[model samples]
Target: MKNESDIISLRLLDQTDVVDDFMEWSLDENVSNFFTRGTFLTKKDAKRYITKFIVTHPWFRAICLNGKPIGYICVSPDVGSDRFKGEIGYVLSSKYWGKGIATKAVKMVAATIFVEWPHLVRLEGMVNIDNIRSQRVLEKAGFTREGVLRKYYIFKRKLSDLVMFSLLSTDQLT
Candidate 1:
């Protein structure tokens, strides 16, 4: 959990309290645009979806501003032999677009995760090739574009590419 400003804080999600916000975002096509799945139509489905993540995700938090949820961020253990790494993902309501909230949340999550797990040396994030805004957010938070992943994901039955970005523990803030 982190609070960089009086207006914004990241807290472990409370399922009961965040259901509406989660549902609201999950149902919006624009908000879940790049997600291959998760075009839920009802609150029940949204809860079921979020509940699964809450259980499996190593770190999941609600991005709140003025006590209202505006987004979410999470980090899960990475695959392969690299125990010192994690994969990060996030989503922000379109209403909060252009507010720099995503960047702050990323910085907070990255810093807190590094401190919480001293062994972690890298954090990775993948953005759909067309999400220039998201790519900028990662770059602003010190993640470097590693390369393109060709035909990396199947979103809405269409093969799409992604831009992989990574931030190293040794990476200094830009």
Candidate 2:
């Protein structure tokens, strides 16, 4: 029998092909509550967001199961001198939470990101202090908790603390 991790995969987010599936999680308040962006109101808006942001993103992929998008993951590299590091982020449909899909996807990224961007030595993940589930995903994926940044930034109009986590290319992936 195939395990969830065995079937999980990542692929580029297609602007026109997965709008409805994208909206499944993008519009769900439970899924978008901790997201940096607001929930998209319509399919057109979702598609527009996909076209304008996701398609152009340097490293963004749809988290897939059985060849369909169930969530998304991305890594944003800093420009200029800080280009050696990148920040990772991911979101999953609420129905898929607790199934280990997020961790699998993150592990997949950890496994390949260094080769894909050889200059990158570090992959970081910053999670809102309140977002324990996401923090757990990073932990399970072999990220080391670096500590919390107090009053890191404003989230949803309120100042939020963020827990910083990182995995170095030299570190062994879980």
Candidate 3:
């Protein structure tokens, strides 16, 4: 029997078939609770999002299990003088929570991102302080909990504290 990690894979998010799978998590308030964006309300909205953002994103990928997309992961690199660092983010279907799939996907990104972007030295992940599950995902993926950023930025229309985590190019993926 294949374990979750064994079947987990990542791929570009440009395919047409992913729209429905994308909706599974994209529409779930539980999944979008900590995201900067609000939950998508319809397939038309979800498709627009995929076309406008995911398709154009430089480092975004669909998190697949047994060849089906169940979520997504991406690294947004800072431009110009801050180009050495990138912020990593991910979202998985709630059905797969607590199964280590997110950690595996994060580890997969950490293992290859530096190589893919040779200039990148740091991969950062920020989580809402209230989102303990996300914090654990980063920790399990080998990120170091740097510190809390008080009132870091407005999240979902409110000032929110964020826990910052990072994994450097020299760091080993756990």
Best prediction by lDDT: 2
Give per-residue lDDT, candidate 2, residue 34.
Answer: 93
Total clashes in model 2, counting residue pairs 3 or more apart in sequence or in different chains: 0
Q: Per-candidate TM vs. native? A: 0.90, 0.94, 0.93
Per-residue alpha-carbon lDDT of model 2 for 1-174, expressed as tens digits? 146345888998897655579888887788877998888888888888888999899999999988889889999997865699999999998888888899989999999999999999989999999999999999999999999999999998899999999999999875
What overall lDDT goes with each candidate model? 0.82, 0.90, 0.87
Look at candidate 3 and give me any clashing residue pairs: none
Q: Give candidate 3 regions above 4 Å deviation.
A: 1-6
List the lowest-lDDT window of 10 residues for candidate 2: 1-10
User: Candidate 2, clashing residue pairs?
Assistant: none
Candidate 3 C-alpha lDDT tens digits along 66-148: 88898899999888556999999999988888888999899999999999999999889999999999999999899999999
- Top TM-score model: 2
Q: Model 3 Cα displacement at 150 (Å)? A: 0.4
RMSD of each: 3.0, 1.8, 1.9
**Candidate 1, superposed: residue stretches over 4 Å from native:** 1-6
Ranking by TM-score: 2, 3, 1
Q: Which lDDT tens digits does candidate 1 get at residues 25-126?
A: 666778778655566787677677767867567788889887788778988787674778888998888877778889989998877788887878989999
Q: Which ten residues in a row have the lowest lDDT in candidate 1?
A: 1-10
